[model samples]
Target: MFDLVYNTIFFASYSNFYGLGNITLGLFDVILAYIVTIIVSILVALVLKVPLLPSKPYRYSFDVSAIYPTPIIAIGILSIFLVLNYTFMYNGIVLAVVIGILSALFVKYLFDFVFPKPLDADEGEDM
Candidate 1:
């Protein structure tokens, strides 16, 4: 979990360091980061059979179609960059890539605080 947070911070900072020569590219990177985070979070949720750390119920009602798109787009972009950079650095070990993916999941949970889809709309309304 710590590793995911650390790597996400590193990835964000690294992306920022590349300078803002291309607005399109910058947007792409942001979207990619978001997507990577979401996908990893979902996978972690399934694998762990629990919400990742820092879980908090969402404010809005559930909408499966609406839920997934943003993260997918974000991850797709960030992944392209991670692959380009990490491949050169680590020589493509599967373990390293898996770690990177896990790290992405960790960051998603850390920053976003996603909880399981609520069973009742009124479940946490008192809070």
Candidate 2:
């Protein structure tokens, strides 16, 4: 469900002349988009709060699989746009911001999945 929303926003933004010809947008517009996406992702994480892994005392196991989805999705989508146009002429700042937001959201979801509360734990339990 979250993936759908995230991908939809990404596709919609890209469809709006994302990596086409030399189009220029204001800095503030780019910044606003980044901020909005980041905030939305954070809110989603807070609301879900699903721990993906168990917390341990000074012992750790990392789930690397959880770390790569969003960037892969973003890069794959951007690569398609760039390949289709044969140019990387989109707004750099905007792209960076978008990628950052996507990356953050992806990581948040990853952590939630990787560090989830124990099975015996009740809802609202803190780790």
Candidate 3:
């Protein structure tokens, strides 16, 4: 009974599984890619002089941080590439680094243009 269960679970083979052609990425590669993503993002953020944390105490702050959105954005982009079967031959690592740098640059330069601050309603009002 145990042998049957083992065979069914681990050894049973299908002709075509998910149409992905039995793509089983090594654990080491996946981990390396993630580490690369994190390291590159933090480095780029530091080079750009982005803060390590948000400036405002409130939620939805406009400030970019070395530890927050940069890594998140990097990982998100990496995930998309991984799902599309682009992670091969250490390509994932390279992609991660590129994404990290791009994200940091975007935060430094384009974030404000893309997400402008709200105008104050009481501005230029005379008391």
Which stretches of candidate 2 lie above 4 Å from their native place? Answer: 1-23, 51-127
Pick the lDDT winner: 3
lDDT of 3 by residue, 1-127 (tens): 4343223223212222457456545555666787898899899999999988998773856576888778988877876666555655564677878888998898788877987766556685446
RMSD of each: 11.1, 11.6, 8.4
Summarize candidate 1's per-residue lDDT along 18-125 as a digit string, tens digits.
463232223444334444456554565455443333223444524332234334443554455553343223222333335445654544454245544556755765
lDDT by residue for model 2 over 40-115, one digit each (tens)? 4444434445233434432443332222333444444444433233222344335544554555566665545765
| Candidate 3 residue runs with Cα over 4 Å from true position | 1-23, 58-60, 119-127
lDDT of 1 at 84: 38
